[model samples]
Target: MTSWLKAAAFGVGGIAVAGLATLVAFQERLVYVPVLPGLPRAYPVTPSRFEIDYEDVWLRSSDGVRLHAWFLKHSPPVAGPTILFFQENAGNIGHRLDFVRMMMQRLHCNVFMLSYRGYGASDGHPSQPGITIDAQAALDHLSERGDVDTSRIVVFGRSLGGAVGSVLAFNNPDKVSALILENTFTSILDMTGVMLPFLRFFIGGSASNGPKILNFLVRSPWSTVDVVGKIKQPILFLSGLQDELVPPLHMRLLYEKAAEKNTKCLFVGFPDGMHMDTWYSGGDRYWRTVQLFLEQNVPRMIDGKLSSKDEDEDDGRDCLQRL
Candidate 1:
């Protein structure tokens, strides 16, 4: 074959390779994705000790997938904010005890730290719809509190949990007291740029191929962009400046798109911290910030529709000092 023909063939093969890579990475079993074993023994997670008390909570999704979680209700009722925490992408609620202990004791709020489908003993698999269903189930469980105030409930998430957080905030802003996202990204496209690098360019480079084909061929179920603007509740975003995993710039870009500036929304950054360790590594300042945020926005129980998105009426967080 002539050199021109050979070059053309090679170019076609490369496109084929790239296309195949995109399809497989996106469509692969998300079930196995959650099942990745603990990190290599040589580089295991070194967790420090903290006093975290525990309790087992079971929730069945609307679809009947039984999920597991830890309900660390505050001891003897200090009565601050009740937080429904979505864990980072990982094993189970057990790993988050140190942080939970600090929040429960320090933040003075009851914390329910829960896992998605397959992470812990939860039945079924992890996927976009599945996790959303799982979250709704847990939210329903929280709604059933007799002594617990539903209006003062807070929703917090980190990393993949942020996507979970966004979904909850978007669909049922009324159920959430306030929304807190840590180390989250703008969208799955942004995440892919961070994870795969430069492929976002090609996704739009030749759009004459049409949006439907582009949509079908594209990978990633983690799109938070649409949900980002939909969330109308008070929001606080915590990002690490030096984070390479999710990148602070992504979160910053997201903060810009939020609908209202008056929703008690603010983006806080740690100039010296990394991805996951921002809170723990920042020490006293971190817990103080977390506690103050809950207190400032969530407020003590006022006894009337605490978490809903009522435009005319305002809560303690909104009307705290102003009113």
Candidate 2:
């Protein structure tokens, strides 16, 4: 009996070691879920339904990867504030048409939705650095456009996109006027622990040791907490109170960190909101909050003259007033 028990223990130990090794080897696969080409019913809606004119744009990343994006222009001749929207991880740009339509029609702004490499019609594989490079390319595309007012550009990212947008806004403060993050987390390691606390024991030394091992293995840190302090632009954090995928506490913590820099910031929470349903759940209030944020942060050309103070200099009192 003693000999049999020892053999079983050895087998269990070997299985655990193999599991850890496999996790480290294929960690990127766990992070990025790209939908390959030739999937049926990819796009559910048409741009014409929103009465917006859109063109298919292909952007080349700094690393020579080609990215696909939709450049949707407002019906008006002179475009308003342009939004460079970064979507959540799971779907292509077509999956977010409703949200884009709302932004264009209700907010009266042009919207640019970018698909990370390896998703949709874009080329190359998706990685932390690769997606960030794709985001920068999207911003550059907007900046070079004659119709867009580069001074009034806003970087709006949701979930995973929030991390990308924060990084972009932090790196290019002069170019991006404001940032809007929805249902974003602090970091992948932190989120992993939150979502799967039991895995911490396997990944780390023990409960006391925490998730140090998991953090070391994670290739895409995408740590928004580290970058939020560096972002000087006005920021708006949208949180869903009942978010199951990413807890609402993450947004609150990010808000606290961003507020530390004396930057203009707003946090809106939906009591019954889920991960991607904040906009629909908040309804009209959601649109109003977004419009208010833009009005406060993004400058407008009034009578062919720039209105409002410089974006970086604004105290964000406008945000407080609305709150």
Candidate 3:
């Protein structure tokens, strides 16, 4: 009996070690789910379907990887703000047409939707650093366009894109006038804890060292919380209280961190919304809040000089209080 028990113990230990090894080896696969290039019927909708004028733009990342994007111009060509939109980790830029159309028609802002490297028809693989480069390239493309009002650029991102946008805004404070993040996490590490509470055992306690061991293996530690405090640009944090993936606490923490330096921070919570449903759930209120933020932050240039003094006169606390 004792010999049999010893053999079983050895087998269990071997399996655990094998499992840990496999996890560490391919952890990137678990984080990034790139849809790959050349999938038939990948994009179900296009701007032309809605009668929106758009240009299929091809950009090159700083690392020389060619990226795909869509520059959807607002109708009537008003000198309004241009939104550099970074989408969630899943799906290509073509998958988000409904939201894009809503933003263009409601906010009346030019939208530039970028497909991260490896997703959609873009070249190369997707990584935290790689996508960040893609974002910078998209921003550069928009900035050079004569039709785009470069001074009134807004960086809007949702979910994983939020981290990308925040980092870009922090790096280019002079270029990004305002930022909007929806259903974003504080950090991938923090989110890991939330997703796998059992991992806490690795840090300390009696749960087992599995989580602690795996934590060190995460390569893409996109810690948005660390960078939020450094951003001085006006920010709007939209949270879905019922978000199952990221949770509302993450958004609140991000809002608190940004508020430390950015007195222009605004947070709007949607009671009936899930992770991706905040925009639709909030309805007209969502667009109204976004419009208010744009009106206050996106500078109005009369003759190469900022003409709007509304942002200077009022802090964003009143706006948050009303929400």
Please state every model's RMSD to the true fold in angstroms.
6.1, 4.4, 4.2
Evaluate model 3: give its TM-score: 0.86
Q: Model 2 TM-score? A: 0.86
Off by over 4 Å in 3: 1-19, 36-41, 201-214, 303-320
Give the worst 10-residue stretch by lDDT in candidate 2: 202-211
Per-residue lDDT for 117-161 in model 1, tens only? 876567776777888888888888888977567888888888888
- Per lDDT, the best of the predicted structures is 3
- The total number of steric clashes, by the backbone 3 Å criterion, in model 2 comes to 0
lDDT, residue 66, candidate 3: 94
TM-score of each candidate structure, all chains considered together = 0.80, 0.86, 0.86
lDDT (tens digit, per residue) of candidate 2 on 1-323:
69989999989788767766766787676677666346642544557666669998998999999888888988775557989999887767787888888878789998888889987778988899999889999998889988888899999999999999999999898999999999998877676566446455534321124537556676887888778877899999989899989878889988998899845888888788899888988888788788888877786988887676665754546544554
lDDT winner between 1 and 3, please give it.
Answer: 3
**Candidate 2 Cα errors over 4 Å, as ranges:** 1-19, 36-46, 49-51, 201-211, 303-323
Cα error, residue 245 of model 3, in Å, equals 0.8
